[model samples]
Target: MISEAYSPQTRNTKTVKLQADLVVVGGGLSGVCAAITAARSGLKVVLIQDRPVLGGNASSEVRLWSLGATSHMGNNNRWSREGGLINEILLDNLKRNKEGNPLLFDTVLLEKVYEENNITLLLNTAVYEVEKGKDDLVKNVTAFCSQNSTTYIASAPLFCDASGDGIVAFMAGASFRMGAETKEEFDEGFAPNIEDYGNLLGHSLYFYTKDVGKPISYTPPSFAIKNAEELPRIKNFQLGDHGCKLWWVEHGGRLDTVHQSEDIKFELWKVVYGIWDYVKNSGKFPEAANLTLEWVGTIPGKRESRRFEGDFMLTQKDIVEQRDYYDAVSFGGWAMDLHPADGIYSEHNSCTQWHGKGVYSIPYRCYYSKNIENLFLAGRIISASHVAFGSSRVMLTCAHGAQAVGQAAVLCKEEGLLPKDIASKEHIAKLQLALNRNGQSIPRIALNDTDDLVAKANVEASSSLKFKGFSEADDWHPLKFGLAQMLPLKANETYSFEIEVDASEATSLELQLKSCSTPNHFTPDVVIDKKEVDLQKGKQKITFTTTKTQEQDHYSFFCLMKNEKVKVRLSDERITGLMTVENKINKAVSNYGRQDPPADINVDSFEFWTPERRPKGKNIALQMAKALPIFEPDNIKNGEVRPNANGNTNAWVAEIEDKKPTLHLKWDDKVNIKSIKLFFDCDYDHALETTLMGHPEDVIPFVVDNYTVKDASGKLLKEVKGNYQAINTIELDEAISTDALVFEFSKKERHIPVSLFKISAYN
Candidate 1:
């Protein structure tokens, strides 16, 4: 409780009046991202949040993972195209704490906000009042900080209401709607035929667990449901564990999600603790005896709340028809997961599908405020009909929506225009270009005809390409690999085949087949041998050469790196004599290139391999001959090794000896190095570090190059910098590279004691 009186002399009491180019209220996923995007584009941004932390319901307080539509369902770890501020948060979290938990979410979110120098974050502050001019545009916002008992007056050229509740819009005199609209209004099939103007779906607190063997004796609230069968048209009990999750049935029945949060919190605590007590007391399973409660969310994840009026309202018909919007900005693939409008057990549990496909497009028009010139709305607050909102309310879709809004805010700040100005073709094109650069996928209809490629391979294009390809290859059974097929190849001829797959599902593709000459020694191969491609959505073409064959052996083709490292071997009988590759027993070649041999070529031990076998007087040709280089810092004169005395000086040390020399370093400091110039007395072409020798502190000498560091056995230790500065110092944070520090000077610059110095390191 803070006093209402203000001491003008005190800094806390002194009302700080500030202005910005853009003001984003609510530092949730959407607001944070919007502020970041706008700020990155040179906009002076002020992000105000009612809570202390960012990330809204996905923050540590709520303890929900920031999942996108492409998240989960086997695509959890893949790089999302909706990678901007959200990606930065996730990447920072992963870097700081690789534990894959939500505890680090707030820190990462703050880092992202702080990383953008143009963004100002105002936390633990609530927008209490709004000032508007005669034109009905928001002039300034008054935010009251309960913690400091101070009110802040802020003015901005543009405003965004990403508060999830649309509080800013409501205060700014913007038109909005709550609860379900009349059936005639939206013409939604699942909408009640009668008008029951009331509260929308109940907010819930979600939790997760991994213990398998457990049947807790938890009795749900009389209001809470036991199964999905209680709802109309929901008969499937096999919808996976999510069907039985704690929050799957519990809800706080309230109209005002913002004000009723306390009630929701009370109900959530009841459900969470009740379930925990039941699980603890009930002797269901011995495995769950140690089942621990990982997290308990405080904020209720409100699915449907305030829907702001925008330039255009996205309707259910558009979703069903898969209508392509010229101003499309985001997409959603999750089904219309509408919760019941009333009691814990209500008729409406889910929404009807448009087509067999569960994906839909959302346009840019749905993201901005109705009357506010430069204001935008993201997340659940977007202007979509209640029916359409049911499908677009998922977190992943919201993330995409947030990303688009962020980009739109940047455009608004840059072009000095309103959100409606972005509706034009050129502006949308610019937005799409930014999105593509950031890896977000924009669905497009195929203009050119590539149907002939599938037809030539005796395949037909179906309504949806994903299931069609799998259906056609159903008869083609899997071998050692799960499912695969082999087709005979023509020598020196290029053949093309297209595979249509769900971009959201497929992670990668490998057009693997046995090498022609290695009849007995099967070398698992890829058509495009140099690069690895992610074949998620769209079509892919595989082309390879069958120049010669040593003997008559079958080659294999299949998809590897599936759910696990296992391979899916295609059918070989369809095109007999064609090889089918197996994923097992096949090792992928390391793409890291070899380093040039040091100037003083010395070898304590040597190992070499050559293509010795010949077929029909045709000798196998060697592609290239090379040896791994080693750095002997001890032999090089004027190469004085020393410890880096920056920050944690104890972490690293450099030394040399009569027989062996090494760089001793702790694996805690991250160092960047450039070129390694060693001075020696004699002219030599190469140098070698012995595998047996271990120097000071038992540290092995490792050669650090541009791209990678390799040990004596030529095993990769760490990813190296491709290009670096001349004076950079190579810091060893991980395993030692080589036991003996050997280096070859390009020219004889020094004699006596070989020295290596002027080692510089930078970011």
Candidate 2:
């Protein structure tokens, strides 16, 4: 027997108190991105997740794949690869876990959060209580950790309810909507006519099955539905198919998807087991004798719940019209996909309709609470009508929304303003600058910073002014049918492209110009001009006149048809927003889809091509005038980074051996410059990759390893050492008055080949 004198106290709960600049509730893709964005901006952030793992629905527990602007390869959004952290995660997944393993993806999310030292992640911590401080602002939130029986009271100036269910907003007395709003509310053409509100999109359960090479026995439980026709969902089930392969296997939306989550999950369980019983023991599938249930998700992935209202309610009309907001911070392209009220049990298809012309913008007004002064919302909980949520609900889109929220929150904290004040003229520009500086894309918004030194000074480079080569040269191949590659050309100008052809016989090639009204669409809107030429073999140049008459430069979809054996140069490398793949007659899946059935793509071959982001700068004339991916020698300098979209190598790379490439900014007279910012290419194309045997990086270490800035007197003003970040913002110790500023950068000891996207200076 032991005495109790020396025993320590054992309490039912342990309390932890924390204070941070920002507190993000919910650890989904949106939450992770939001936390990371704010934290990376040098703010103290605390990210709290209810589940043990990060990535919310993408976590192992839920097992849903992240889908967004790419639209699961089901649509024509070929150029809509999301930029920033979302793009990083996707490319990383492609390189590392092309298999799309839920557990492996979970680790990537976990590692990203863990690597950010400014973020305080509290896993297995569910926030259930929130209190208001002075001026009815959110002050503190209380989260309980069931794993350790610990309670955490997190305090912050701002809170983000990325909970997907709007938990934080609900607890903070924020105004929110539960279901579909009437068309009269927002003039949404797709809105349900009757408006029997509260009938929401449902929850889904996913499972994976595998063949073990041996017969597996399964005893059907009493609750299993014997007949496949009972639910009508068994027909879609196939052996070895898993995850969202069975997306329609859903329920619980007609009811309260949040409060009745458990009930919905229980119903889903019965459906899953019943279907498996039909596949194995129901005598319908003898081939499944060796198949067994590998894994089934216990937690249900909720599609719609409580949506906190903001300054703006994004409507289907807004998406269809592509309404541009002055405070635009992010974009969404997934169609306005909506389901029937009955969900999977409905007689009609699971998805009733998809709206919107193409990719659309999401504004800053819809990201923050209208009534709750200190609360910001992201993910599915953002302010959108039922119709618009269908588009913005996708994971990557939500992550971008979170990125905006995080950035805006940081700006708010820094400026000491409330959530609603970010829309002012001065602060809105600051917010956009922050997003653009971090590589977040705001569609059609170009950074024309006035303080750029290169814009005012004469620029020169050591290399050829023309782009060296075409990105699609290696992708060239023979095509029996006609192939088209869109060329971006200025109106009333002539452009030429060189082709390398090896043919058994002479071929008659017909070239035609297809007009494009929508700049981003992959196919030609109409055919306007045509030309024909006879080709011999080896190498040849073809010229065409850009007569579309559009004032601003627009894409010209040019089609080529060979009457004989001829190979045309083609490179359809995947770059963001440049080359898009689409032929009117031939249609194919652009890439892998998360919803696709289980199959090893490596062993099975598929040809993918799209000159979607083809760089117009490859034309010798344009390269001489416009500055490109880096600070290359060009006539025009708008201080934009990686502005060209259609090339595999978007950044300007210096000569292989000439590591010390110096750029001179010369003006007519001495000017006072206060600061300069440099944009380097961290290899945006290679920014992400997930591999089993090797670890990849978020940024390619191919930037200016060493650099020096000098005044007209040749005196060093600022010097940077061991540089790796994508954007470098420098504040001069004192304003220097000089006619010329020199930037001299060198590669590392091993000939690193420095790359710069853009550089700007401000007074």
Candidate 3:
């Protein structure tokens, strides 16, 4: 190569032009999901990110675990994990990166995006300019990449702004709010006071540690704060705490979170180094002598910035009341968590969280900008009041809502309509049906696709599970606190239960039968009956029959109040629609067994009944006088996918001893089918956190590991092995005309029985 001679005063950078049907800015989970979803839905998408890697906060650069509705299993939201593309990502992560290595997680995200041919990925590029057309539409966007010394001009008919700071939205002159609103503004009694709790949420930095088997020495930089004792929350530190466990190592709520991000990062670093120094040399953590810092986040994970306005702003009332919306598109269940302005130095507790009795719906109106016609708002910047953002700002929740944005973009292109037009009555149903077909579950909404051939076929199974309760007792569980067994029952039915227990001494056991006022909710706020039984010192059997029948079908809680002298028998058998929960606290999420907030906060106070993580959470060993026939082959055609508190188990489960579980669909005439989809049990109640936490198994135990599909002639059409996902979409090489179809599942000697939620055939 030769250098240029007598060059001009300056030379411009290389410029490139790109076009797409949809342009997504920001590589966080929300934007990544949006781009991938739209790309799969037949849209040419361009994904732009300022960072080198995708996943934003969930990337190796920042490393915060992705959490949503399950909330670490700290609350009462059961079987509430987010579905659709995000669920697939989480399941994939579990299979490949069960150890939760952030680097591996980054690769998973990259692989997912790379698998889609319609997506164009641009990384290490920041968008700094925008070009607008007539009628307040965005015609094009300009971005510059310092790493490559290149400038990119990308144009698209629709745009989505998932950048953490809403950079594109701000440059496009979108209306936004930077701080919290007044308590009286939206009747949000839980709103924070500006002078006390502060107006904005803050940024946090995390680190990882490892043991070298030898003493490791560390010296702090000149900028590191030597006065570690001055930290108000210093006593809360521990040698083993790292990653998201140190989420409280935050700052910059009082500063400009967007403009002064560097300053905020520096402050967080100073605190992190100071905290490490304290752990190393402070003489309090003798066990940390061989530990050394393995990695530290280069940038802090931002909590909140500028929130853009949409057609309708979500408020505290919507979350607390669990309100339903006509334009509901998504849902959120994380508690409303708010931090203090002083962050690590704050005198108040690290955070105050208040949760609703159940998950609430999110409307489609809060997805797109109100003034910016062609713009869409996603992630933490979606339209919501500060109090509501405290719950909806989580990564999976943001990603789920952004998925709706992706699907909406498809409808916008197909109908030649704007994003706002999709919120109308004429198009809302279409949007919901499309999302449901894609495996996204909306709360309280069932898929009613008339095009599915299964709706017309008669479903018959070799054997169905009869609800007779688990009888094998494997261990004894002490009743140190209140314990409840969740069981599904029908209306106008009297059920009898027989429980075996061991008593340390003579005591009286209080058995309370309870159910939620709302049939679809898990909160057992209504007490139906109670009984007091006396127990002797030895083993005993207690039998109780319900005196009254419930008015409607719902899951009732058979609760045994705390009686330290007694221990109940537990079975190792685990079922799809059954679980045992305890009234306990998860301290990490501030669940104190029961939430008794001050009356002025305008929040509800209730007990938290959460399930234990497996290998430990076993069902109660009891017997029912009569078996209930709830799991029938006809359930396969039901509109609901998962078992609900208000509805019966919308699944067909084979008997435990059924050697070869089979399902047959018969039709009067031959039908041409091009595709077949099957929905299985992956245990939606488990919170599949993306990073840091290790899981018990790679594949969900309840999922069908091996299965085969056959046509009317008994010719093998397709076979699936080692399946771990909830939705299985199989496309035939050519359309098959048959009068019937049969599905056969391999029997495995495991705790979970073979089961299926739904099956559909389409041409």
Candidate 4:
């Protein structure tokens, strides 16, 4: 523990007073994000966590691998990821904790807080009291430091309740609900038939094993469920399986996940210890001879508890239907996985059913307490039905909300308004803009800030866009029976659509283009065009075009369908509107469940493309032609990070063959500039696995390896050497007055192709 870093006194008689623009309660992913985001936006923040270390469930104590909307791309939600603060954690984790060592992971989170000058982190501080003033606003919070024994009273203009259990909100009398919302209550098809069952997803504990190399004797725990049969509900138990799999061990849903958190933890411990005993001591486990217990968690990861009420309570319907909200500030793509409250004791399955299409939007109204004027909420406690919560509760998804609320807190402080006030139509856009400017991914909101030169100025490149990526075995879809590919198309426009087919014989192929799933709400609806073509066995391209009448929706998603014999190309490419959807031919296998070429998961979701782009340098132009996201020089000023970090689609590409390339920026008004920040194409989606088993994401090749900044007169202003990180910045000794500035590269990293995600200059 890092307790020695602070005072060692166990008890203190005095009260400590502190003040800040924002005070975040809880140090989990949500709180970490909320605190860091607000602090980065120029607000003083006090982040308090009850634990001696950080990263709640994902901490060494619990050891749960962080999961979110993308579900690790290869797993599901192919095109999804929690971009802002959560992504930063992933990237930093890639850089520092590639081995996935829990202790090192803790250090990364702690160091991040320490690096943020605007944040004051107070560890082992448990908040137990909240002060409320007129209009139900929070005045301050009182927390007791366990080690130092000092009571800290932190007063701030705004407060964020990321305390997994909504402790701060509960103490402040924030309205909340426990248990499942009735199916009719929110029209959640996934809700239990019963009205309001308090049964919730349970708590779970994890254990790690090490190979002793030599056989070792085993000792059985007295409380071990010796005959694994005692827990028949848990099937396919294996010593080799780990990480969020059912075999990791879970329990306690029948009991209150919050009020009985301790009791539930104890029960989970019994289950974990017993399982190990059964694996080692019972005659059933011969493979356990060489494996020994390396570590077991003392703390259990709690899944559900008190969910605070917000302006809009997210319902299962919202997730299944992919509801669009003008105030949307975040999104979640994890399936609505609801386990029976009975947990291990019950005979029911862990999850009810995986829900509809890829990632869905999360509105801003769900981030703040409905009645608590100053209380904003993040993490598992945010307003969402048990079913929807099943999906949003994932750590990375929670981190997304944390970023939204953090940005909103900045707005609340700057505008001198309440959370509700910021929710107003007038101010909501400002909040979104702030989030966008900071690189948070708010689904469906194209980064179109006027300050972005790409969105306003004329853009040109040295070459036309070239598409990269080979058509591998996993790069195409067999469009037959029930599969379709979503293609974003313009209204009343006809464009050539190509298909790559590998048919064994010249089979008659019937193809159709249909609208997106909604309103009609099913695949292959409102056919825009239909054609029947004969195909050959080898790779062949068939181009078909269709024009929609103006009567059709101004812009609608169209899907391409083929007969059973046809196969369509599924590029690893990232295109603005290329999504995939399919109907399950059988209940056991969902189109969304296919990972062969994850981009073609049958579920109606965007193709999950990790680091969603081609390897750098190879597709410098073709991917650009496919195009908008091809890291055009305009993207530098687009005010958004590439949707997928490691991918090239959302990045601009350049080849360093002859003279090093240069990017020149000119302003008609000639404004004074003080600092410049450049975001190189670091391949955010470049497959970064948090384990030593895999390799690190390439250190983005296009980073300004060595570059010089010059004025319009060609005079050198600044020069940087051997740059390798994603973000490189230089604050001038003093503000320089000029309408134009130039960044000329002397040398560029060539390990991979060069790419840039974004660049920003500020006064």
lDDT tens string, model 3, 321-354?
Answer: 8888888889999999999978998998888899
RMSD in angstroms, all models?
19.9, 7.4, 1.2, 6.5
Q: What is the lDDT of residue 738 in candidate 2?
A: 90
* Residues forming the 10-long window of minimal summed lDDT in candidate 1: 681-690
lDDT of 1: 0.48
Report the alpha-carbon TM-score of model 3 versus the true structure.
0.98
Question: Any runs in candidate 3 off by more than 4 Å, and if so which?
Answer: none
TM-score of 1: 0.55
Write down the lDDT that model 4 would get.
Answer: 0.66
Model 2: per-residue Cα lDDT over 1-763, one tens digit each: 9555654876457899999999999999999999999998888999999999998887888887677765544444444556677766665565457556778888888989999999999999999898889655899999999999899999998988899889889888889998887767776656664344236888888888888999999987787656655665555666767777677888876788888889888888888888888788878789989988988889988888888889988887667666778888898877677666565566655664353334677889899999989899999999998888878898888998789899998898888988899978778888887787666767656666554566778865554223322344444455454555544545554444444454557666776666444543432445666777777765555554434444334555456653447656654332222332333221222232112212321111222223221231111111112332322454235444543322222344455556577777788988888888777654432212222212233234455657998988999988998766556778888888999878888766342345566666778
Candidate number that wins on lDDT, 2 or 4: 2
Of 1 and 3, the candidate ahead on lDDT is 3
Top of the candidates by TM-score: 3
Ranking by TM-score: 3, 4, 2, 1
lDDT of 4 by residue, 552-623 (tens): 332232334436666665544332313344433322212243223222222234232112223311211111
Per-candidate TM-score against the hidden true structure: 0.55, 0.77, 0.98, 0.80
Model 2 root mean square deviation, Cα atoms = 7.4
| Clash totals, every prediction | 57, 21, 0, 30
lDDT of 1 by residue, 1-763 (tens): 8676766774656587879988888887888877887787788988999998888876766654444433222111111223334544543454455444455657777888988899878899999898886455888888988888878898987788888888878887788988776667766554533334244766767555444465433444554323333343333212222211333434644446667767766765565555545444545334455445545666666666789999888776666455678888776644344555443434544322221122356888898886887678888889888777766775556766777887887887777877888988878878865663343444441122121111111111111101111112222222223223333222333323333332335555443333223221122322322224565443333332233332332232322222332222121111101112222221111101111222231101111110101111111011111211112221112122211101000011111111222332222333233223211111000010011111121110122223333333455444434221112224455434233222221211111112232221212
Q: Judge candidate 3 against the unseen true structure and give its global Cα lDDT, from 0 to 1.
A: 0.89
